[model samples]
Target chain A: MSAANPGATSPQTVHVPLGDRSYDISIGNGNLAEVGRWVTSLRKVTHVVLISDGNVAKYYQQPVEDAIAAEGIRVTSLGVPAGEQSKSVPTAQSLWEAALADRVDRKSTVVALGGGVVGDLAGFVAATMTRGLDFFQIPTSLLAQVDSSVGGKVGINLPSAKNIVGAFWQPKGVLIDTAVLKTLPRREYLSGLAEVIKYGVILDADFFAYLEANVQPMLNRDPAVLQKIIARSCELKAQVVAEDETETTGLRAILNYGHTFCHALETVSGYGEYLHGEAVSVGMLCASRLGEKLGVFDAESTQRQAKLLSALELPVATPKLSETAILSAMQRDKKVEHGKLRFIVPHAIGKVVLTPDVPSEMALAAWREGIEDESA
Target chain B: MSAANPGATSPQTVHVPLGDRSYDISIGNGNLAEVGRWVTSLRKVTHVVLISDGNVAKYYQQPVEDAIAAEGIRVTSLGVPAGEQSKSVPTAQSLWEAALADRVDRKSTVVALGGGVVGDLAGFVAATMTRGLDFFQIPTSLLAQVDSSVGGKVGINLPSAKNIVGAFWQPKGVLIDTAVLKTLPRREYLSGLAEVIKYGVILDADFFAYLEANVQPMLNRDPAVLQKIIARSCELKAQVVAEDETETTGLRAILNYGHTFCHALETVSGYGEYLHGEAVSVGMLCASRLGEKLGVFDAESTQRQAKLLSALELPVATPKLSETAILSAMQRDKKVEHGKLRFIVPHAIGKVVLTPDVPSEMALAAWREGIEDESA
Candidate 1:
């Protein structure tokens, strides 16, 4: 009932202003039990279709169900297998059918209580069920808390593409309990920190410096430090999302800072080869090198990110995948326009730009440079 | 190319005013050939995914593809089997895969070329594909032009429920060519008039009287009369839609004047037993009778709707089905809030109300009264 860490920072609320679709991200420590009141405070609900994955459900499902049920709201707990594979059409269909079988009505709300995959899949289910249900997110993973939960982009993947089917369905509110990250597997927890670092590099120099200063605390999952980073990440993302909720304005693309290389690496290497943030760690370096190649960024700035990511135990060296495959995937990326390579290139540690029309050779050079010298 | 009916009233436009989502419904007598210009006039497009059913594709696909191609835009024409069966998950998946295979980018538009099924299915595809697509509707059926095409309610059906998964994805523009109805199957064409008449009954006394006076012209598919009725119906529905784009406000509920009973009838009789409009015809009578039973409407008004629907050649008599099945289906209708039955009861022509807590026995009695007596 009380903060797990006596000196933990007070809970913070980041308001994402999207007019009628606007919602607050409530970041706190040891607040998972408060989900019932948290959801009811935002919207009246008679039923909740609580969706999580096996990994998350094993630990948090019962608590969330009991909490929401204590509020006299009916809870229909549905689980999918953990990992990216769960974000598929079949999983989504099963969830929708299960919810319907449980008698979900228009008045019901969908509560997503897990990492990015669960959040995206459940959010997608909420978006389409009965033409959309009121959605609340209780993000258990740091990556989801900092990134996916703040934006309204929810979707499932097709065999040919990831997130090929989806919508911009904003939740009624987001409830983030940083304490949940305590149970995250080490690699997964550290993988999430890559995005936390991304918010700093893309938009906030001061936040970047803060992450640098607290690398040790971040590695240890210190409650106070975790709360600060997660809240700031949500705030930064919420600001960008409020302005370009649907990615229509091009303003939001800046958030994809290292994603161009990251997506190619993910695609060509085959997804699940590297966790998203691990790839992002390598991708950010490639993007920075590309920025250097384009003469807009300095080598020393790239070195700073490499050092921080290395210290945090993330994959800094790009895996040795086929350069041709990477290039083709980059060309096919959503960020590309008219067969031209586009990337969010960093200009400094804190600022990034959406640069267009970069040549394939130069992008390849960026990728080739990140190849670890295994023989050396 | 000029219109087929040279004296057909000049093309009219009904502007659905929904802030930035606002779009024009272009009502013309033979503008199908002008689709390229019409689409280009609305939004710039490099590629278009033209979706239709086998029946509709045979008639309009080539012309539509050529017309859009003539505008220097690429077209990916995809078709599904005609009828309600096409509005399913498999059909939608095929469309999505085919569109992706043909290289549908975010800039690509989805143009639905057919009846209500294609509009709803394609719109649902357009809604989910790439998080959303700029959609254009070329409604080839009167049911589509006057009803489904205007509301922005697009989705496919689940085996368990019709339209259980979907979105309110507004099209960038709607192109209605009344001349296409000339090739529509006789029964399907007559079934469409049922909704046309319902629009008159629910919204405008003058419109209802216009329908009454023009029943013969309607039967003949008079271009001028078709233009007028279609435009007025679009205007009325558009006005309601603009007021309640997502059906959150109860104002949109009035648009469902006969849908509760209609859905029940369709369910108990099994889908494909009644064209949507045919079901609406019978359901509207049941609702009108229910209104009379509750003392809010008179028998004369009920008879008036029956006369118009019958004159338009739509089925008006309720079929013999299990009373328990019919009542259960009604209870399970989306219109029902909680366990209570809600009916859009008509007090007079052009004036229906969302009446709640209507006794199930009385609703059953209303259905029983509509049955034709073999002895008589």
Candidate 2:
């Protein structure tokens, strides 16, 4: 971990409550030089666009732009070009004309220093350059410190939809450090332990029996079990994006338990083939066999979530491709409704529900009982 | 004056309030076939995505997409390439890949129709496509039925900033018809009577002495004085956009009284040569001569708004241009701050204020006391 210890400790915060678009996420372990007294202690700063990602600004952008220019706060930074085709729309219209040619305005303050495509393209250039600004998120990676930096779902992506252009905006603060997952790469830290065993199989069953008893001290990267599983997956995705911040109260589609077969196996086996928590570990065994073909789960809870996602090495089967191209990419999912198919499923371990209109031959017989059938 | 009288009369509502993003504008003359029962009487929509342009989809997109597909909703519609270079970013990325190839999800319902560049590019494709949608506005001109259709602001534009990229979203309804200003073009209906005499110079001296006692029934477009000056300029811009909706309460920069010399005379007279209410009728006489060179207003109410914007034909002087290119285009506007020069001025004619740090030789001596100088 590219050390910059300004006296370590004090971090785990969380608070995303969103009334007046709330803030705070923090979390620690050498808190990357306390990102300028954690964003000028939430709010009044002069200027700081920041944004990063030429591979996390070649190991954390000069000590995070010299700890946000040692608080006089006039940073600018900028970087892009690192992956997922830099989340397009001409790289968010050339980062909104390069943050309006580096003079950003409306009391400038973007931050988003890299990972999850620099927190969804710097939280959509701070949710539209001038129409909005004050945003902050440090994220770094384990799939953006437990699911795209505690949710105010910012956007960009439309080569025919995927995050299909966005903005729920919310940030004001979100640091996360886990000492930059000690430079990740162990298959992207076991593909962010498949969304940390999908928040212990959808919302805590003793954090899914404490990740099946810290599977070998979470496969030996144990710094206090990675700060108690990334602060319990950012307090279970800031309590489902503070009770559905903008998923218009369908209680945030039970945090998309295995994101509709991990976004139709990351859109028909093609978007950097897995590594979205290894397609949420093969979309949590096709939503635990579509919760055992809707008899509300069990087949030994889909072999205890495929022996804890094959003991955290991940990919619990199901990628033999074309089940009519994974049901036409789960009928183009942001939880497709008007054309039907919706599913959050799981029932046993720490429960789940959002199962509406599911019968397409019972979700293709729960993706042909996770294949290996060979017409048997 | 294309008449399609679906039994006219009943419209005049206003509402805007904001709690739960409150809405309702209605106003009428022949309620464009009650725009699908005033947007399905507020919400349970099905699918709309209407948008529009190509010059208001050639005389109103098939009667507003056949009156919202004759109330069975599901419209789709699209269209672009009409003006302000189709509020760019490659026409909002080919309109988010043609509204996700006409299947725009998240409970689709955009509408927009036309004018104010098709309600700011279909209210910025109903605020960032799927991140927001439930919108509606039929505005068809009179500068978007009185100021960008009751202000939920939506955006796009950045060949170096102009609506830089946007969203304030808002619009569950706002029909306005005044029979589509009888197909406008009388110099865009006297440049929308200079923002309907700038909501009577900022907020209504009896709607600016009732537009100086209805100038020949508002130069004879008089369909009940163009529905009483577009319902009193959308009830004074929906009461300053419901007391400052996202222009962050400097009480919405007193609706930019002569918008800082009408955005520095629409940026040194180059943008479609002054039809933003004829550069707010010459930036409301250079903000009423910088409110009479800061002795807080009166050149007998700036020649009573220059004899009601020259009896409604507009362009009341000051366009001799280069006063250092209209003070470097009013210090690159979204109400310039950290570079000083903030404006809005006029303190009488129903008051106005926003002031802050002004001096650049008293706003260029209120732009050289509006030229026509001839050394006197």
Model 1 Cα shift for residue B282 (angstroms): 1.8
Q: Which whole-number lDDT from 0 to 100 does residue B145 have in model 2?
A: 85
Residue A255 alpha-carbon offset, candidate 1, angstroms: 1.1
The residue-level lDDT of candidate 1 at B126 comes to: 97
What is the C-alpha local distance difference test score of each model?
A: 0.90, 0.80
TM-score of chain A of each: 0.97, 0.36
Best by DockQ: 1
TM-score of 1: 0.97
Distance from true location, Cα of A148 in model 1, Å: 0.6
A1-376 in candidate 1: lDDT tens per residue? 2133354567888899999888898888878989999888888888999999889999999999999999999999999999888988888888888998898877889999899999999999999998989999999988888888888999988888888899999999999888899889999999999999999999999898888888888898888889888888888988898888898899999999999899999998987899999999999999999999999999999998999999999999988888889998898888888789989999888789999999999999999899899466
- Least well predicted 10-residue stretch by lDDT in candidate 2 chain B: B1-10
| Alpha-carbon runs more than 4 Å astray in model 1 | A1-8, B1-8, B374-376
Docking class of 1: high
Model 1 over residues B1-376: C-alpha lDDT tens digits? 2133255578989999999899999988889999999999999988999998888888889998999999999988888888888888878888888999998878889999999989999999999999999999999988889998788999988878878899999999999999999999999899888888888878898899888888778888888889988899999999899999999988999988888889999888987889888999999999999999999999999999999898888888999889999999998888888689999999889888999999999999999999999356
Top candidate on lDDT is 1
